[model samples]
Structures are given as C-alpha cells and as structure tokens.
Target: MGGLEGEGPDRLLRSMVVADSRRGQGIGTRMLAALERYACGHKVLALHLLTNSAADLFSAHGYSRLDRCAAPDSISQTAQFSTLCGSSAIYLCKTLSVGD
Candidate 1:
C-alpha cells in the first residue's frame, strides 16, 4: 500500500506483502511497480519505507539502504516512524523520476 503522508516530495510505502502461500510469484513486485506509478502520478520525487524484513525484495527493486536519520522530517515525524516501526527497522529509499 502507499501512504501519501506528509507534505513533501516523498511518499511512504507503507506496506507490501505476499501471503506465504502466494510467495514466489511476482505479485509483490507488480504491486510495488503499480505503487510507484501511482506515486509518480502524484508528483512524488521519492519513495521511502521502513522494514525489518523484505529489505532484499526492496533492494532488488532499486531501493537503497539508508540511515533512518537521513529520512526527511516529513517522514521521520510519522507515526510509522515514531511509534510503529522500531528503531532497528531498516530504512530504504528510491529516488523517482517523473515518468518512472
């Protein structure tokens, strides 16, 4: 899912999951692609997410590991950042282009 939270060039990629029974298929990737398209349409310049798992999947899709502190204030102030996800959660970001 996509969380169009905050007022900035970034959009939060809240969550993306494929059921264990549905794993190994391309559903998650397709979902991510669609989410990116939607974000691009909304003028989002980047997508960020905090994950303790699925880092490999995100990395495979071009998200790079980043320090959580590098997250913009718009992102860091969210409940997901401040309360939901733990301090050890991995932060990942992907810079987006208009047509991406």
Candidate 2:
C-alpha cells in the first residue's frame, strides 16, 4: 500500500485498493488513515499519489489536486510522475505537519 523511504527523503504510496466485495465498508479510508499516520511518524513532509479514478476518495481524505506540470522536484521524479501515471492521471498531495 505504501513504500518506506529507505534511501530517500520521501515515501511513495503507489497503489491502494479494497477488494470489490469490500467496497463501501470504509476499508480504503482506514488504509489511507494508517498511511498518513505512518508518514507523520516518519517525519515525512508530505505524501504524494496518483489516481485514475479515486480522486473523490482522496479529496474526502484531505488531499488536494496538484498540477502535474508544476509538481515539486521531490515528486516529479517518481514513477507515478515519470511513467506509470499518464498525463491524465490525477496528482494529489497531503502535507504532514508536526503533531499530525
């Protein structure tokens, strides 16, 4: 669901999905909450992810849309930034402040 920054400054949350049968059970929301906690605990400044169809879900979780053309340097080099995610892919960001 997420990657730790073993060799870099930021972590990557590549993919998160709940089984089809589990949809609407709040599992995805819980997963995202856990990921946010992990990021905050690790002192990560922000969390970045791309979604093709779950933009609403992310928005509900406090992530804001980011312009791909203006993505931050730290995130612009990620796989989601470079290839896996297409130009149409939605970029979302969430800042993790102290005590978050």
Candidate 3:
C-alpha cells in the first residue's frame, strides 16, 4: 500500500497508514522515510498524498500542503483523488532526491 503511481517522474504516494494503536511510536515516520528512499531509488522526482487528518504528520515529515487544483492530470485522474478521499482532504507534495 506504500508505493508510487503515475507515469515517469510524476509519482504519487498511493497509501501510507498505521493502526491507531501503533501510532506515536515512530512507525509512520520510519515508514515514510523508507518509502521516500524506495521512491528515490526508482527515480521518482516528487511524491504526493491526499489526507484528511494527517496533514500535521505529513508536514512534520517535509510534505507541503497544496491546493487540489495544483495536482497534475496524473494525480487528478486517480481513483483516490476523484473518489476515495473526501473533498476536504489535504493535498501534499515533496520533491525527492536519489539520496533521500
């Protein structure tokens, strides 16, 4: 569930979650770092995510909030963007380096 989507350099982080009971134990932080490392390994230039409640968490990890309209077609067309997450969901992005 933690992987990128889209064509070429337009990657999006499809899913990242941890059980509520396991939260605050650094799992999400570690998982996100690992996810970024994996994405970087595959040459993903940027990562995007949609969230309703974890904006603070993502922000703390270096993701910046973005307007929904800023999403490119590759992200806007996804089922997660069009249907899964609610309209109030926060859109976030971060540029990545191969060494990230």
- Candidate 2's residue-wise lDDT over 1-100, tens digit each? 4444322445566679788899898988888888778778777877777889899999998888988766677678876689888889998878777677
In terms of lDDT, model 3 sits at 0.86
Candidate 3 TM-score versus the reference: 0.92
| Model 2 residue 10 CA deviation in Å | 3.9
**What are the clashing pairs of model 3?**
none
Clashes of 3: 0
Estimate candidate 1's alpha-carbon lDDT, on a 0 to 1 scale: 0.87
Give the root-mean-square deviation of each candidate in angstroms: 1.3, 1.9, 1.2
Cα error, residue 15 of model 3, in Å, equals 2.4
- TM-scores across all candidates? 0.93, 0.87, 0.92
Enumerate clash totals for all models, in the order shown: 0, 0, 0
Q: Which candidate number would show the highest lDDT if scored against the true structure?
A: 1
Which parts of model 1 have CA positions greater than 4 angstroms off?
Answer: 1-4
Task: Compare the candidates by TM-score and give the number of the best one.
Answer: 1
Q: What is the Å distance of residue 21 in model 2 from its true position?
A: 1.1
Over 23-94, each residue of candidate 3 has an lDDT whose tens digit, in order, gives: 999998888888888888888888899988889998998899989999888888999899999999999999
